[model samples]
Target: MARAHRREALLAAVLTGALTALALWRVQPGGSGYPVPETPEVCLRQFREAILQGDPERIRNLLSEEMHPHQDRLVREQQPRLTQTLSWVIVQTRQSGQSALVLVHEMHRDGWIYPVEYELLYREPAWQISRISYLPPEKASIAPGTHVREAPWGQELSAPPEPSRTEGPDPEDTP
Candidate 1:
């Protein structure tokens, strides 16, 4: 009877340890101490990294089902080669209920910065990018109170437009 009690106690302890470990694993934040992205902005950052890294499958997974048809073409056009020096920063994000618009500045090796807008939809599990459009410089207006992330590598974030002046005679001509 003593031997039987000892065996049952050992089994119970082992089962308890296994259950505790499993519970901790499930509740752990990303298992690497960094919490998993639960916001649209963080997810968009992940998408940007995936683009820079040229991970086609990750990029496809981050996009919505509606964008699947254009995945091939998008990957061909937007995927930067591993050798290319490129970076991106979020210029603005607007969210209303299930839809969101994220504006980002994509900077290339050359001194060119492009404003790209991504439309995202909050599906059952997470936000998925639905559409992407490149805006002309004149069209990319930043709203007040919008958070603009700084560009990496000393790149200029943006330049405010100069105020328009009424057409008048030049100072030299007037003189």
Candidate 2:
């Protein structure tokens, strides 16, 4: 019984140490928990942080070279809202070649969620954001009363209708 107790205590100690180490690693800056933004998803997270922190320099650093001219405009558009933003959740990411689209939903403190998509291009050093577009909220299912299928709008062609009292109807009596 004493040997079993010692083994249990050793296992618990090892688990507790591992958990603490993982927590610390994630909290440390520049660590694997928050390493440099190499992919589109990570880059977008940095972009979100910069916008919420109101750091224009960081924002400019993350933009593509073509967007350099619009730095001032972009900086002016995003204001510091660290308190207003609860978190930015990444919904999906689509990547093809050097371009990527990251969909993110920004949860606000006011119970509103706004979706935004970021277009990023892979540059030499890292991924750079090229465009930002807002997306409409997705519906769970299509609304009722909406047409599910479509047909041609123009007049349809078919055989002409037969007369109700045709002169040829007398042929029936002959038959």
Candidate 3:
């Protein structure tokens, strides 16, 4: 009876260990026990910081050079407009395998929200943004909406506003 009880206890311990291991595996992020901490949030935070600092070099470091030519073209063509009216506000991110898709909403000075999509790839153990594609907020079903509008500083600037009398606390007034 003593030997039988000991065997039963050992079997129970083994089964418990196996179950715990399986649970951990299933809940783990990267399919293995080790999870990469480079999540979409981290990526967006880094991207935002780079942009606000106006550090194109840092932004380039976060992107694959394979994408540089296309990005450069975009920068040259759109810089004049984008610099004025567009800022990135990341909305959501989804990850699968070594790729992530980031959904961003553009905040315009006029309070318009435009949806854009970015495709990011992880290669050589580092996450690099590969492509940026604009999408219709209504999903791919409808026609693409305008991605940007003309702002005062953009290429399509309208007549400048009349100079404000508020400027310089009235030149005629004494200090």
Q: Candidate 3 lDDT, tens digit per residue, 11-101?
A: 9999999999876652222233333326655655565555655656656656677876675564554444345445566788888999999
Candidate 2 stretches with Cα past 4 Å from truth are: 1-36, 80-83, 137-175
The stretch of ten residues in a row with the least summed lDDT in candidate 1 is 26-35
Lowest lDDT 10-mer window, candidate 2?
Answer: 26-35
TM for candidate 3 is 0.48
What's the number of clashes in each of the models?
A: 0, 0, 0
Instruction: Give residue 42's error in model 1 in angstroms.
Output: 1.7
Q: How much lDDT does candidate 1 score?
A: 0.70
The CA lDDT of each predicted structure is: 0.70, 0.72, 0.62
The reply for model 1, stretches above 4 Å from the true place, is: 1-37, 81-85, 137-175
TM-score of every candidate: 0.57, 0.53, 0.48
Q: In model 3, which runs have C-alpha deviations exceeding 4 angstroms?
A: 1-37, 76-88, 137-175
Candidate 3, pairs of clashing residues: none
List model 1 lDDT by residue over 26-81, tens digit each. Answer: 21121333223456897787776777777766676677889989988877777652
